[model samples]
Target: MNEALVRATIPQDLVKVLGVEPRTDSQAEAFTRSFLKNGIQPNSRTDLNSMLSHKAVVLGYARPKKDKSKTKSKRAKGLNARQKRAMKIFHIKPEHQRYELFLPLHELWRQYIIDLCNGLKPSCSPQFVQQKLLKADFHGAILTVIRSKCPSHVGTTGILVQEFKHIFKIITKEDRLKVIPKRNSVFAVEVNGFVSHIYGSRFEQRASERSAKKFKTRGTIDL
Candidate 1:
């Protein structure tokens, strides 16, 4: 069946519903002439729907119109350049790094750890204490480097000011900030007479990551 015949066979009601104007004999003849001139065949059977769709595309009605109000712009993930630069510029001032200023913070941390360890009861299982301490936040806790590869870091006690992935920044009793690497270092904290030792080498993770991570127990750990 020819395209012209197919168009002619379409019902009048469908042509009205599709909002299409029926092509007259003169228009069809002109279209056939144009197709032949362009080296195309007009013998293919094209349905009314296909014809209307083609007409819509030619008139630019088929392309979807974007509504700015309905389309939401996606927020970029993580810190931007400005935030990174600002972080570099803003740091704890030396004058404000007094250990006395963080005494209240240390008290709060002591209370928090005591509560986290279920009051640090004598009957509490070692496994439970270990699990809680593994995920515990050490910010504001008084950490004393009991043992370390660096002899100078040994016995250095201070309030933990900040914790990084591989470093611990602490404000010493002398009101100085000491950057202690977590590699091959051991820190101890006493809470209500219950002393807990933190092996830094095994805890080389951010607080957020340590909270979610599962640690496997080995017979021996290096350092």
Candidate 2:
């Protein structure tokens, strides 16, 4: 299909993929534009009949509650490939002049960690972390935050936030990076004074456990 036809048809396809019961024509159009830019796929039809004979869009006749505006649309930025992939399971809604989308269960855990850090005083400095990879106190504090903050630590013991190592290094030493969340959860944040979902994770699970067990048994750092 040509880009225009594909683009034109994309609104219907995205709603099918997004599973939102197809609310409005504008919502579908916005979704299609974002989905195509992000590289999401559409479902299959067996033949021309399925595509043509079944002329009904799942919620075709329903009109949107609000008028669609280019100005409102432009105010909200677009989604990239990675963000789109992350949002595959999320639910999207129109509100407050933007699309707010989320993965409910996943965010519950992520939010807990963020809330904890935001509550804590910034006592653990980066020089303290980098020079002494063995900052017993701060390391202990981090592990405590992880355990209390994340139950999934019982599994991989906490690696999801570890992906942001580049982000963390700045917070630890010379640079302070800040994260401003987008309407979409997966949107990237810029840094300055805020810590991102990214932090340099030399956070090793096995080593921490081994060291703790050894200290308990022999009362010494594991070497």
Candidate 3:
């Protein structure tokens, strides 16, 4: 199938993939646009259909959610090719993004760890992580924030491991540092006080501004 047809059909497919259906056509379009804008690829109608069918089957036999306190047997360290592909196309609406499409790194990391415990193999590479975050519907503005806040750590495997270890106490420091990156350089420090200027994330600020404007408009209409 052509890209246009695949793109056109993705919204309906997503309704099946993700249980929550958008209420209106505009909302559905918005959600579809976000998925396409990010890295969600609908290779072909048949492949997309087959993948969703498999997902449905998997959901039927899916294991119950794991408790963090309970000790679980560790699997392999890195994900295989098939597992990597699965992670790339996995589509579930982020719980924290009910109000908006962005979430904090802390929350994202927490969810990532939980998925790890549940036998999900996450992409350890920095570039893969960036793409995964975007595909997961995190706003692009977050890259700006992360780059500024952690300039020294950007694109470095060591810092990625350190941050993951810091958030989720499961991974050993030695094990975390084992997955070395190709590059480890503290390049130009584009240090900025933008993150410090805002109380929360840029997404949060934008959401607040939109909400205030909407509320004001509604009040005027009522008046």
What would the per-residue lDDT of candidate 2 be over residues 1-223, giving only the tens digit for each residue? Answer: 6877754433666777877573477886676556544543356333433533564435236676775564375566789858976886222222411211122322553444335444323674533322232322121111111221234222121112211212211111112222212111211121123332212133233334423542222333221
* Candidates 1 and 2, the one with greater lDDT: 1
Q: Sorted on lDDT, highest at the top, how do the candidates line up?
A: 1, 3, 2
List runs of model 3 lying over 4 Å from the truth: 1-79, 87-141, 144-223
lDDT of 3 by residue, 116-195 (tens): 33423343533433223222321212221223244544443211211111121111122332221212222111112211
lDDT of 3 at 57: 27
**Model 2: residues with Cα > 4 Å off, grouped in runs:** 1-102, 118-193, 196-201, 206-223
Reference-based lDDT, each prediction:
0.82, 0.32, 0.33
TM-score for every candidate vs. truth? 0.67, 0.16, 0.15
Residue-by-residue lDDT tens digits, candidate 1, 111-161: 998899989899996677777888889999999999999999999999998
TM-score: model 1 vs. ground truth = 0.67
lDDT of 3: 0.33
* Residue runs of model 1 more than 4 Å from their true location after superposition: 1-72, 80-86, 217-223
Worst 10 residues of 1 by lDDT: 51-60
> Better model by TM-score, 2 or 3?
2
How many steric overlaps does candidate 2 have? 11
